[model samples]
Target: MSTAIAATSEIRFVLDHVAQIGHLAQSERFAAASDDVIEAIIEGAATFATEVWAPLNHAGDTVGAKWTEQGVVLPDRYPEAYRAYVEGGWGTIGVPEEHGGQGLPFTLQTAVLELLGTANPGFALCPTLTVGAIEALVHHGTPEQQAKFLPQLATGAWTGTMNLTEPQAGSDVGALRAQAVPRGDGTWSIKGTKIFISFGDHDLADNIVHLVLARTPDAPAGTRGISLFLVPKFRLDKEGHLGAFNDVKVVSIEHKLGLHASPTCVLSFGDNDDCVGELIGPEHGGMRAMFTMMNNARLNVGLQGVQIGEAATRKAVTYALERVQSARSGATDRKPVRIADHPDVRRMLMRMAAQTQAARALVYYAAAQVDRTTLGDAAARERLEILTPLAKAHATDLGNEIASIGVQVHGGMGYVEETGAAQYFRDARITPIYEGTNGIQAADLVGRKLGMGNGSAFASLIADMRETSQTAALTELIDVCDETGRRLAGADADDRLAASYPFLTMLSVAVCGWLMEAQGRAASDDDLWQAKKATTAFYLNQIVPEALGLAAAARASSAELYAVDPALLLA
Candidate 1:
């Protein structure tokens, strides 16, 4: 099996048919993204991801990144990869023309990044975080700030990192203790210790911009007190020239199960009380400003699931075709055939392929809504709020599931690291945990998102789903989704929280089923779209039924959950 699978045709199908990215091109903001241009961009990205990025995956995991006294050192080839990515203008996709980018639709940017990640997820983190940072600054930064930093970041000459987590605060951002004090010279002194910072301190870029969340003197307590700051690894002068050390240091990097080349670092700022940072937004609106970046990362994180699913499913399918094991049960000759010929193997493979494709559909659809929202579509913004969590939670969850099934399909070879099937599993384990726990995503969905527009946004979503749910299986699943949404709305907090995960699965599967059915109807019968049609059918026939079982769990009370004593449960 090849190290990478771009899924180019599949992605373009979603962008063109399901996501309907051509609508973006109709708008002046994305006029440059003509079909021919988009196709060429995707083709070029596929080649870069395949030729430049894919080969780095195994070594990124095996040799990994190192934390030396000098800084974080990547394996020798990693620098060449980063430089190629920068010079190719890969990072500037979707950024405005004025910001020194290609000025394409965000839909295209997402499609291209998905290809890169599908090629090399471990090494892809650097560019991914940088993309998120660019978005944050664009939305919240002052004109001066954008003037100084946006161009370099847009070009990927300098990378970026989000510094929100600390030893004391992981999911609970309110408990953070990072501090920033006015230096009386316009700049502020930021001092904090950040943990679990991805691509935190790397030698790959010329300079790293650390977006830190900290508090100031006499601010209100809890989340309300927090402020967002831009602290660079090296101080920048008026002309954006690199200067002094700025006292930011990478104290250590975590040794992890996977993604070794993407350093998760323990960073200390203002160790000598000289770190200078400029505020990005309002004084006490750190959470609000950070959400700009977090939301971008969340969608991209979900795409990580799509990326891994594509890679894992391709690997599994490749191995199944080659690894001949058993004779056909009904065969008279008793000749050994490829495992792909076996009924059970076919079942697993179809499930993997269908679920993976369903996830890609959801991600692209959500990405399209993002493009529409930018064009002042109110409905799109509301739908995007609801779709973001589903995309992040469900896709990443499927990434883990599909990657595990990839291992299962490989049987004995899947367990051994030498065959490299296990690496996909190990790498996928972090997606659901890192962005925000999928459980948290579920809670947010039920707690706040469902309540948007007094339930009108969700109702609108259901109406859209009903339009595409022509098949009985999809029709039934979407109806369950509507009924379940109403049921959860009226349920008590405990019941809602208890059923959150199951409810998330129920609704997410319903949405995916709708998309697949819709895509299947419009897909051409050529060899290129055969996989799409087959997977769409498999998902509706086999996977859509899972929604029924999930609905029952979603409707179940929170009683049994609270029945067990918390301490005793752990003990």
Candidate 2:
């Protein structure tokens, strides 16, 4: 199996040209992130990812994590790799300085995450969830909570998890039955069974903070009554030192298709009626507080899709260049040639490369918007609200598609587990399902995001996409957006629901086209620019046209969809 390599040059190019990391550095919030410092950080992270993390991917996948009477145990190399990750300050790159971090821009941190995720996503999840946890605490934690948890979490000494799902309530979070009762001592007793908790328990960190969602006795029904709580694996005494167990038990770790190194555990809280938790934010405000972490998590999840696609594309490209096959059809001499020379193979490779590049541009652009929000740009923040779901759903869908194409590029070798192509496919499958399924994302786009601030957010986005360039691709995108916006405006609730997924797809494809055009315009006469231009052409000519079909689908009414009986579906 070929090892996955980070495309440092491509990443640097996107960070500079598309995301405009320099402009972000000029912001008062990011004044410390000079260009040289950013470059050095990216380069250093790339080296660590390629050397320390990539080597453990295969071992982690094969050996997997283990569960025993003691607890969940990761593969041997993971501890050393995680230690190096913390020592290198990779986990603290984007955290605030007040929390014992270097305080770099989130855009730069996102780029670093791309490197780590591409190298090894299983290992990357620990830090990813921790960052989300830290963000939640920063926004909602009390001064005392911040004093006790923020520094350790920001420095990567303690990891975190978001506990939302239950056996009965997977996507329907309102259906959760986890119970929390006031202990009358500035804490609450929480009891529930949470499932599909990633990085729930690991030996790599001293403590694990779980942001749990549960209901109080007198709270209202459904989501509104739910509240967010901070539950640590180990209890802290008055002096803020780790003491006894907190009654958070890891029942078992899942045996999964991919990302075997990442332990997905079913956690049982308060099984012995001794679990204690502290409320975060306001009472009965779990949804709002959790969204703070979930929104950021959704964006990172989208980047995961981009990361896997990039890794798979690299593997496929390498394989095509080395594998020999029949000569070109027109050749008089009967000599073999690299499969990369075949026209069909070239098509497949181009699709993988182009789609991966476009997705990278979208993810980075979204991350930049996040950075802009920190700089106090209200418009940028609004734009992020619209871009979030599109980035998450579109990138993940492309990740799965591109990985399947990657397997096809490798032929029979891709089918066998040893070649590692199948692993990419397996790992990518979870992105769309978790982090709010793509279906939910699409619905959010059409139902909620489109209507934010009387539709000003999406309207401004379309206007910006139109103003970005005058290319034919952008023109097609503009038309699609205009039409979808029109359909959504007059759409009945049911009709809009039916068209939501296709509308999100069209919008995502159009955004990718706009970003590609931007890349082409920014290119110099160098070889990298030349390659960018060619990929842009391929994306515009081949991929952008899907928007027309999706737009048509988005225009379809719900009448036909609902005309079919529910009994027929079961039949």
Candidate 3:
């Protein structure tokens, strides 16, 4: 059989496997969310994303949001689409009960985001930031702050923006200089300029609540001095109504390479000395507070990678099935069969399918980790903390690769806007750049995740690998896992991180490989399972070794990057 047919057949096998896992079933939050409501929500989200959002995706990138002296102006359709989102109650998914949210698990939230991002990445930014803001307040905000903000944010009455990056401090949060001065009346006056704030200024909602990071007068230098504060565009009265303009203004907006419909803004706080803000958490702990939201944002970004990958993969698969090219050896007629029947095309599509599925599985597992930590019974929380960064970084990196391959499969069509593959590629590019950057995530893995409990966390990771590999159902996966685990033993932090990373990558591949097989074995149709089994073998034999190489590198010291000089990086 041709690779295209084999790959599609493989994808069907993978979905069948996923469905049996009961991912779409009503979660523990069902009672609070309402009976049959979760299914309705999923069905509605899937339809809206596929129908409404997908159509505007190309247009959003082409037209983008306009930046002017007045403010940022998005493409015409965003407002209506956002309204539909609110009408569907999507904005309230995964929120707390007291705040009018449905309070669903991260799994449900993951499903929603996957569909939404696949539909439109630019559009997804609005709620992504809103949820991030809601999380910060709910977790670290004072009760008054939570009472004031969560309900509106939960209901999508207003949207939220995360203000972290500044011109001098893109990746380094310690370099931040935004200042917050305490006012005797319990509020603070915040003065800062935040650049690259997503959904910074939008007409999608009544107000934009900014979670700002700033320093205080008596604070220590560096990250230790920074604190998080809430700055709303319009001041809220004691009764929670819109009061007056709070000195927060959009200085300008950025014109970017992708995600045009999502307004990226440069925000100036306290330009007129009237920016009133409320503190979140404690003094000199802004980074700690922000980490919660940042972590969530990273996972969401990873999902975007999957979303774009799936979109591009679906498009490529369609084209491969319908577009007839040059006839090959097996062709009896002068005319070519679908390119999907071509060996090379099948290879490309299979590669795309495998990588995309791996990304999805890794990210979803991470979502499960997070849910276990957040809502799972107490025992699972600690392990979830250790696994979170791996999920976020690996999934996103895979997302970018998957989207890139998606374009390649489309051949020349992927490059052109008309084919829409390029949009997926363009949008997927941002995943590794934002949400704390993939490099930073790796560093976190080394510095914090592995180092936690004096390397006990890493030890636990090894134990998990051992247990996973011991499963007879996952023999191929276990072999990959065992090999990777053996390679990662006795490495320093940086090397361990590097090794662990690719090891994690390999682990994801092996896990998905096994998942595909296990799912294929139970498949109702023999032909589909045969195809799936082939792809599974291909992934294990071919791709799992790349992860092994990373493990080999991880077994090495940081001498590679460190031994090189700053000038040597130059061509």
Candidate 4:
């Protein structure tokens, strides 16, 4: 089966059984997202992703995007494929109706994006960043700003980039030195170097709207003084037509391990003092505005995990079923058989399928909560706040793990670049690093999200998991998660920080386990869902028990960690 086709089958099952998307349709805001409409959308997007996008993945990876003085040039058919994506209205699927979009639920968008990302992640990154830009502009941009940029971004006529990282400052937003000075004509003069800007320069769109984080003159130090600016590559005239260059230059692009088609550019603004920008949020409110984009982005990035995992798993399964090897143990004839006949090979394939499906369930569940909160569900908002970090950190960690497993299942051929298994591994490597590294995600979970709503958010999560859990091991995992969370609250800073990762994994596995059981129980006796049921059993039975060990690691002494001096760890 086509990878996108298989993914659609899995996602459809999740929507029907686990994601609670039907409940979302009950809301008047999402009432138009009828069952038939959603099904059509998924089927159409699958076709588009596989036909228009999938064929380009290998070429995009091999030829990649080339950096030119004028702009970044994508591989063959990249522009036409992107144009087809926009014309198909894929970008407008989840945008609000007021912004010239179709106004579907974001969960649907997430599902569709997963398909596209699976087909060709390097190309899909362009539209993904555009979605985040539309989100930021919708929430934080002024009425004038919205009227000016939202239409273009919502429709993908103009792509967008988030420019926050500088060479000197990585994760510490407080230390950024980029500056935006008021030009006394309603526009600001933005001057600074932003490194690692995805799609910073590309020929895919008419313009690139950069959401830049910078300091304004006379503003306070650190993040308090920071502000967000909407700087475009090309300026518009009085008639709102494309005009001058605006001095937004792509100084250089990175030579990365993967995602070669996605231009990770080092951009220079105001090189000749001609870059004009408009403030996004209030003065010194860059972090707030950026977080509005990022919180949404974190969940979207979570889908990347599903994307790569699904792609890798599908490829690995196909190879396993086709490649012939020695017969199973104790076979009388010892005839050659498909590697899939081996018990250990089957075990690896099962784990990959189960974990990928589980991650999909968890992220889609979070996406459904986002839809609910849009319709004024207060509790859903609290749940979304907690689910964001879990989805971002956990699903991405699985992406890496599953991709690595995909390689191992391929055995020797996996090591060769031609087999393409290695590319997924290289691409999956960045998901956990970017969009707030998994480490930061873990810290957010322990320090902020766990305590949200006066601890009610996490408590409510555990309570809900118990309500849905179908197996004892899952219940036990949830219980351990609860215990670990409580202990960390009373522990020292070092211990709490040290325990963050394991607690994150434990909680993530519990959430996935609970959702898996729910899916399993609700599945039909049909061929497709029968496999879901089997995978769910594997998750609840075998994988869920791994959390028991992780729980102990969660309580490991910070003293043992600090026992090694920082100096010894340095290169």
Local distance difference test values of all predictions, in order:
0.90, 0.90, 0.72, 0.89
Q: lDDT tens string, model 1, 1-571?
A: 5659657888888898878988889999888889899989999999999999899898898999999999999987999999999999999988888888888878889898888988888888888899899999999999988888889999899999999998988899999999999989778999989999999998898999989999998889999999999999998887789998989899999999887779999999988988999998999999999998998999999999999998999999999999999799999988999999999999989989998989999999998998898899999999999999999999999999999999999999999998878988989989999878899999999998888998998899999999867788778888888888888888899999999899888889999998898899988978988888899999998888877888778888899888888999778
**Residue by residue across 1-571, what tens digits does model 2's lDDT show?**
4346567778888999888988987777788888789889888888889989999999888898899878899998798889888878888888888887888888888899999999997888889899899889988899999999988888788898999999999899999999999999989999999999999998898899999999999899999999999999998898888989999999999989888889999999999999999999999999999998998899999999988998999899999999999988799997999999999999999999999999999999999998898888999999999999999999999999999999999999999999889999999999998989999998899888888888889888888888765677668767778778766866888888899988888889888999998888888898767878889989988898767767767888889888989999998
| C-alpha positional error of residue 184 in candidate 2 after TM-score superposition, expressed in Å | 1.2
Q: List TM-scores for all candidates, in order.
A: 0.98, 0.98, 0.89, 0.98
How big is the positional error of residue 54 in model 2, measured in Å on the Cα after superposition? 0.3
Candidate 1 stretches with Cα past 4 Å from truth are 567-571
CA displacement after TM-score superposition, residue 301 of candidate 3 (Å): 1.0
Question: Any residue pairs clashing in model 1, and if so which?
Answer: none
What stretches of model 2 exceed 4 Å from their correct place?
1-3, 566-571
Candidate 3 C-alpha lDDT tens digits along 1-571: 1111112233223332543224433455434444255456566777778667777776788888877766677787777887888888887888878777877766667777777877788888888888888888888998888888898898787898888889999888889889899899989999989999998887778888999999999788878899998899999987999999898888887867788878888898998988999889998889999988987887788777777777777778888888888887666777867888889889888887767766776666666666656644453555556556666677677767877887887788778888777777777777777887777776666566655666665566556555544334345445655554554454566666666555556555555554444543465555545645565556656666555555455455667768878897895
**TM accuracy, model 2:** 0.98
Output the number of the lDDT-best candidate: 1
Question: What are the C-alpha RMSDs, in order, of all predicted structures?
Answer: 1.1, 1.4, 4.0, 1.3
* Ten residues in sequence with the least summed lDDT for candidate 3: 1-10
